[model samples]
Target: MTAARTEQAPGTRAPDAPENDVVLRLEDLVVEFPAGGGQTVHAVSGISLEVRRGETLGLVGESGCGKSTTGRAIMQLPRPTGGAVVFEGRDITKLSAAELRETRPKLQMIFQDPISSLNPRRRIPDIVGDPLVVWGRRDERAKVVPEVLTAVGLDPEQVADRRPHQFSGGQCQRVSIARALVLEPEVLICDEPVSALDVSVQAQILNLLEDMKARYGLTLVFIAHDLGVVRNISDRVAVMYLGKICELGETEELFDDPVHPYTRLLVSSIPSMETVTGADIEKADRGRGEMPSPVNPPSGCRFRTRCPLATERCAAEVPEMREVRPGRFAACHYPMLEPVGAGAAVEGA
Candidate 1:
């Protein structure tokens, strides 16, 4: 485990942030789904996060960790079961359907699968222009669609008449981005936007997104399972396990010195240049297990079941997210690292 460095706390923020600084805030957000047989799947459990203006906040976790669910809740796709979603200081969860529709254009989502996101029967222009049409800007789409298409590295004249089937996966993703940006949204939720693309194409799309963010002055909530991708693109990163955030801090800080056992596992799991053979693979498998089902997650700490350092206290009491070090927060009974004189010494110190 890495030792916690003493630095100014980055997680601490003014209660009243400047009006222009915070684009979105999620307060104790919760989302649940009916799984039939009187069982409910706790997809998201009291997660709170904020997206600062012009910054990318990465939400990372394995599949079924509720990263996507948290993103959708912010957009009020089905409205969360509990907690408040404040967008630009207004509680969007309380907005009526008509009101939400009017506000939806300002918050757009780019899904994981690019090919399926587009309409196969619709032409590129119409598909990209759909949001504009919905917002009563049909006539202006002629001007808007071409500009967005060009911005996303596609030829306006050549692809304008093409259907979804005519484009490759990378091209289709570019088109999807063009469509999402056509409305000139303020906050863009990119849910694993590059996970489905080829590695070479993924780099292209990532670069394109960075360009688009600057051009549009957009705030981003980037959700992904790839730690490298998230660290490369995000200013801050939040680590989720099961349905709760286990750690949140600056990307470089979190990756360099993860305080949560789960986070350490994830960081260590990232593939390196060195080749792994028989003995190394066996040694690497020590104390690791498959993720538990969210429907019946562990009682106290959701991650306790698989956490290597879990103790009886971890199973008896839920660990709240607290500042384990300056600007870094973790929810663990025994954080891997701690600031000097804060509590029990660092695990190996």
Candidate 2:
């Protein structure tokens, strides 16, 4: 995170954000799929966010919270069911197939399963350079491929001729990064890029991403369930619940003083330095009900069933995101951090 970071409250300009600097924006994005028997899986619902140039925006949430779906929606992978995906001042969702293909080079994604993302039969150079060939830069593939491969710390001489299975998980991820960078993209959506690796390897991949971001002058949308990992890498963090954003703020601020009930639970559940034994999953599970299925998410506030602060109003009306403090926003009728004139009604108060 940058020392001079600006807080990013939705619908308001940060002091540091100049007009035309936002690299990507999602407006009222929605994604849904039929679950058979007249049911619908609400993967993402009415979520809006933006990523500024050269900034890393972290999307944090537990499994099935739609963070990964949000990232894929940004790529227009399935063409979002509603709303727009604005990239570089254009709504990519409206682009024709040819236009979208042309725009893809500027927006790339790194999937969670690195080894599976690569082809088991293809050599490294062919895999990394395939984008060039597909995008009509086949002539430059020979020169550009090795440069990015070397940039990602893989020796072309050694790994370029080998297949993905030969490399360890971390090395395979490096290859994935190299492939994403081959197009010199401005935005990289990393969906849990380190979740499958060893703890030590996770650090290496995170550092590698930081290096790659700086080297390419890239903006990143980093999606992961690990709060600790997001804290270490993201400039700003958006905490998601069910299918919507519950809180958004600068990294340290959100972690140090979480305002949303869900955010508080997530931050507290992270293993502290004193608790090397790791988070007490059983204990944490006992404190909250099972996350509702997206096919039938709770009305009004999806987290009300588990929130200690939930009220009748929380169940009756949806909470719109509002500024809880300077540059921090939370979508809760009864936020953990109450306003100055409001009563303090949080748990353990």
**Whose TM-score is greatest here?**
2
Specify the highest-lDDT model's number.
2
Clash count of each predicted structure: 1, 0
Put down candidate 2 lDDT per residue, 1-349, tens digits, no spaces. 1222233435433446775788887778899999989999999999878788999999999899999999999998788999778787778888899999889999999999999999999999999999988878899988999899989999999985799999999999999999999999999999999999999999999999999989999999999999899999999999999999999888988887677778867876788885312222222334575788999999899898887666788799988877777778788886766422243344334
TM-score attained by model 1: 0.90
lDDT of candidate model 2 versus the reference:
0.84
Model 2 pairs in collision = none
Q: Estimate, for each residue in 1-349, the C-alpha lDDT of model 1 and write its tens digit.
A: 0122122123333344454687787777899999979998999998877678898999999999999999899888779999878787677888899988888899999999999999899999889999888888899988989999999999999986799999889999999999999999999999999999899999999999999999999999999999889999998899998889899888888887677777777876778784222322222236478888888888899888776566788899988877777778888777767421233334433
TM per prediction: 0.90, 0.91
Question: What lDDT does the true structure give each of the candidates?
Answer: 0.82, 0.84
Q: Which sections of candidate 1 miss by over 4 Å?
A: 1-20, 274-285, 338-349
RMSD of 2: 5.4
